[model samples]
Target: MKMICMAVMLFITLLSAGAQKNIPASDIKTAMMKATRFMVEKVSNRGGYLWNYSPDFSRCWGELEAKPSMIWIEAGTPAMGNVFLNAYQLTGESYYLKAAQAAADALIWGQHPSGGWPYMLDFSGEISLKQWYSKVQKGYIHCAQEHAHYYGNCTYDDAATYDSGMFLLRMYLLTLDPKYKYPVERCLDFVLESQYPIGGWPQRYPLRYEYVKGDKEDYTSFITINDGVHTNNINFLLACYTLLGETRALEPLQRAMTCVLALQGGKPQAGWAMQHKLDLNYSPGHARDFEPAGYAATATAEMCRNLMRFYRWTGDTKYLARIPDAFEFLESIRYSDAQMKQLGKSVKPGQILCPTFVEVGTNRPLYLHNDPDHYWVDYDYHGLITHYSSTRAIDLQSLKDEYQHLLSLSKEEATKDSPFIGQTDISGTLLSHLMRGKVQQADTQKVDSLLTILKKKDYLPGRLPSVSKENPGFSDAPLPSEVISIKEYMNGMSTFIQYLTK
Candidate 1:
């Protein structure tokens, strides 16, 4: 038995050595360069990208069907730009830097006159965009009821502005280019000027309060926390202050933190809603019928995590103070077996699973079902919307454990690792933060897998996400079964970059 085990061990070692010998680092580098060039030159729209695109480049999408001229600011465009910068950082490649610069230029051009980005931009011009808003966006009946009208304003929703700002910040720090510098300052000014008196920011600035939800006014002007509105804005400001020595961002950063504390619901219901009114009350079911006026389970969990982050940043116990109450609130709202069965979820005790939205005062779980014509909300978890997560899993114990861990740390220890503190050399600081835990250990197997895929095709093909309708109101062109995805390319390139950096 001992002899057999030794033989197996020797065989495994030889296999590992042979695998390493077969795929050289230069081969991986060459493959990454080829794949990246294909994405940048062929798939990209003026050095920008959407979520995915048809191989023939005839069709594309961000949140919806897009004009070839349109680029998404949400996750697609900024994230791609970041990947390009990551490549440049890793390889010292001027082509990657040029690609990143073109993306920055596109973002700069798309920047609203108000100094932020829209969720989507039409490079074809405003007339074409307005037409899309009236026809395609308005007609596409999905969860995006918010896009039914074009406010012609900049948004903080879904990290749109902050992501764009952060990309520009990185560009400026890397090159010290005055062009990137001006936009970064403009974005900071926009964030500062748009902040509410109570320290929260509206979903959109230069607020247009026209879109009505039944009887309530549009929640776009409300203090939004949905999709990390405050967290994203505050983090961007913090980065700006820390990395750029922008003193103007300091006060707003403090105010934003305080506002997050203020936004917590009172007693028994010490949780959070997606958005809050200008008066700092829980926003009504204004955004969507499915997203009713309630303490959102996912939002509360994220807020708890954010509070922990804030505590780490400032070494303040105040941020940790309400976390226990929030966790307790989450614990109280744990779903029953019947509710779980109705929602098609298996019951697991000691595992905190519950409905996405809890009633504001009563703490009862709320489930929703919607069709093209109407939306219904009830205690019944059956027939919930396929578009949204009607049920959310909360990590009460993990949160509690994390809280204790934070509490264990001394003040200096807690604040020392914060990006806002003791960080010098913008490029080094940004790269470390950006590439933190990214390929800390080499995964040659992953590099091998990625190289294999690249060898088969120049681009990765992935199914289009968030496509609800067959003929999604935008164009007569048929949606492809799958497309060359910006996300896939980013992920693949990121793996390559991480492998190389390691």
Candidate 2:
């Protein structure tokens, strides 16, 4: 009788704990609204939303980076516009509609000649003819990058076909413009034609272009083929095809998905590497020429995320079947306690090809940097939180528990006499806690306090801080008194908002 009573009591306690885990919808909405407004205010300007805007309306960057501009326009602009769209949907506010239209106009103006966008743009109307060629040459680094740049440039070459197609698809969806449909169809046809016999798209088409103009034609041919199915390219292509509801897309997507599956690293493997004319070997952890292989984890995770979406749209069991493998791959790369202690909380993980990092001291995987590149890994707090929210295999309860652990760990680190003061990781960890949906009112207050400190210190500026190797400062970069360009920050914030809204 005593044992039975004890067991029953324990069960009830667990049930109560589980019940308490859910965050109130009202509270979530409030926090989300506040954060959204803060982000929007940081990006918006008289012309439109600049990519990045500091809290004081000074210090923005990448208003000129054309590629980022298109990404912002495609990913972020829609997000901000959607906020108003959502408002209109719920409350029938004309103000939201006006804001959405303005955002759309700004994005449309950012488009390049080829119906594509450049990676960067000079917001100043001072792009010379020489600069134009320079931008064009740089844009041809890879098919996807070129496409991104091309879409911004408003060009209609074969290079811009895939990304341009996606943009067109989005435009068609947004404006119900029949004009977009023709381009989208044409681009899809081009993409299908470009696929290799092995069922993969190349990193870039006509790959013979040397890195330098004077260099010997690297492949001794006018057209060089980077015929490998990269994760991003494959995902984007799959997404476009899936969106188009094209029967042709199904096979290619499946093949690409399967190929990605075959690339998974473990004791037991799936497929072997194939011989190709172009250097197709890009793997994780091997430090070679500029084409490093170690940036696979995040890529794989992103691909899986896209595949999940593809499955969602197509209801294809095969796409669904691959989810577990991809999930397992993500799990395997998760930075363990051993890995965390090895990598440290301050120093970013060495060339992370993985999605989630094991929070220091707690050993729970939380999404952090997507790339191993120092400049690129500048504390992607929003991406991490978004990935955590989107992951289906990982239960919400586990996420909340891990988030709490990360929060406690961050608080502990902040109080310590550590070297990494005003680092973005601190903010990222705090953001993770907020996203966990389990923060107590007191904890939320603490987060707000820390955020205030970070904001006042100008630590949240979107640009990479120039750290001195000889004498690193408390903060990486000085706060700008005048506003920088707005492209990068607006684009980044908009990307974050779009992900959340979706």
Deviation (Å) of 109 in candidate 1: 0.8
- Backbone clashes for every candidate come to 0, 57
Error of 2 at 501 (Å): 10
Candidate 2 lDDT over 1-502, as tens digits, reads: 9999999999999998776544343443444344445444444542244344444543333322232222244233534454444444444445545565555455455554333333333344334423543554443222122322222222222223333344445555556767656655655665565556555554334322343223222221211112222443454455554455567766766666555444443322111121123334422221112212233333444445544444433344454454555445445545455654544332232322233322222323333333322212222334432222211222323323433443354443433421123333333333222112111233333334433433444223345222101111212356543343333323332332333344
TM-score (C-alpha) between model 2 and the true structure? 0.45
> Which prediction has the highest lDDT against the true structure?
1
What local distance difference test score does each model get? 0.80, 0.39
Error of 1 at 331 (Å): 0.5
Residue range 1-502, candidate 1, lDDT tens digits: 9999999999999998887845676887788788889988887789788887788887777877777888889887788888888888888989999999999999998888889888998889999888877776556766767677888999888888988898998899889999999999999989999998778888998888888867767878878888988888877888878778889889888988888788888779888888777653644334666777788877788889989988877777899888888988888888777767655676444467877888877998887888778787888766778888878887777788888988888888877767656333444665456433223234777778778888899987788776533355666777788788877787778777767665
Which stretches of candidate 1 lie above 4 Å from their native place? 1-13, 16-22, 280-285, 346-351, 418-431, 434-445
Positional deviation of residue 94's Cα in model 2 after best superposition, in angstroms:
4.1
Q: CA lDDT of 112 in candidate 1? A: 84
Of candidate 2, the 10-residue stretch with the lowest lDDT total is 465-474
